[model samples]
Target: MSKVTPSNIEIIEIPKIEDPRGNLAVIEKEVLPYQVKRVYYLYDVPSSAYRGGHAHKEQLECLIAVSGSFEVVVDDGASKQKITLNKPNKGLLIPTGIWRELENFSSGAVCLVLASEVFDEDDYIRDYKQFLDFKNQ
Candidate 1:
């Protein structure tokens, strides 16, 4: 697998179909660099609450704000960037070995995550110091 860096984080545009009633956006594997193995969503988050303060060792993820909006801060030990997710048709691809933090969630914001791996506790680095050590090595 290619190494993930702060500069490599990509914003993908999902296909959208408009209708009078509502709009629909489709997410497929063709638009992503990895095949998705898991899907999850975060909702009902309090405005003061923050999520995802960890880094994955092997899992890659695509995060989308399917409703409302939020901000994602990504770090690669040496560099960091903040990305805003306010549209349903856009996704941010986060690869392995990058630390991430979610913050600034608007009311009723929903974050949809598409993961490249199943849930594995060993794949996670929850501490920022440990993440830096891992990256340095």
Candidate 2:
């Protein structure tokens, strides 16, 4: 796999359909760069809390704010960038080998994550120093 960088993270715009009742957005494996294998979400985060302080060795993910907003900080050993997710129809594509942190969540914010692989503890780079070492390798 290629090294993931802050500049390579893509913002994907999901298709939205307007209706009298409610708005709907569609996300499918066919529309993304990788096939979806797992899905999860984060909600009810404390105002002072943060999440996601690691990188994946092989897993790729798309993070979407289903409700409210939050900031995602991504790092690639050398540089970092902050991205805000406020729309349900937009997602941030996080490739492998890039460290990420989620913070500054608004009330009622729901972060939905679509992953490219199944849950595997060995695939996670949870330590910052280890992540840097892995990135250098």
Candidate 3:
């Protein structure tokens, strides 16, 4: 497989049909473009001050700003990348083992995260320093 990066994080735009009456969006399995094994949303969040400070050992994720906008900071051991995610129909796909932080959320922002694995704390490298060291190794 190819390497992953903030630039390659893929700003996927889901198909949206707009009309004077309403709007509609669709997310097809594996066409959201990956197998989505878990789904979660982040809301009612206060200013990060500090947040997400971790990396996943094997889990992959796709983050969508379904309601508003926010920023995602990712570190790939030797380098760091910052991504701005907005637009309800767009998303960011994060590969395994990369450190990620979510912040700068706009009011009423609802972040939807789709994972490649089910809930498992052991897969999470929650300490920033530890993540860097582990990733480098």
Candidates sorted by TM-score, best first: 2, 1, 3
What are the per-residue Cα lDDT tens digits for candidate 3 across 1-137?
23347435666777788989978878887445567889999987675543588889888888888888889888887788888878777778787878889999888888999888999999999888898788668
Q: After superposing candidate 2 on the true structure, give the runs of residues whose Cα lies further than 4 Å from its correct spot.
A: 1-5
Question: Estimated TM-score per prediction?
Answer: 0.93, 0.94, 0.87
Computed on alpha carbons, the lDDT of every model, listed in order, comes to 0.90, 0.91, 0.80
Q: Write the per-residue lDDT of candidate 2 for residues 1-137, one digit (tens) a residue.
A: 22344758888889889999999999865668998999999999986899999999999999999999999999988899888889999889898999999999999999999999999999999999999999888
Q: Which window of 10 residues has the lowest lDDT sum in candidate 3? A: 1-10
Give the clashing pairs for model 1.
none
Span of ten consecutive residues with least summed lDDT in model 2: 1-10
Q: Who wins the lDDT comparison?
A: 2
Candidate RMSDs in order: 3.0, 3.1, 2.8
* Off by more than 4 A, model 1: 1-5
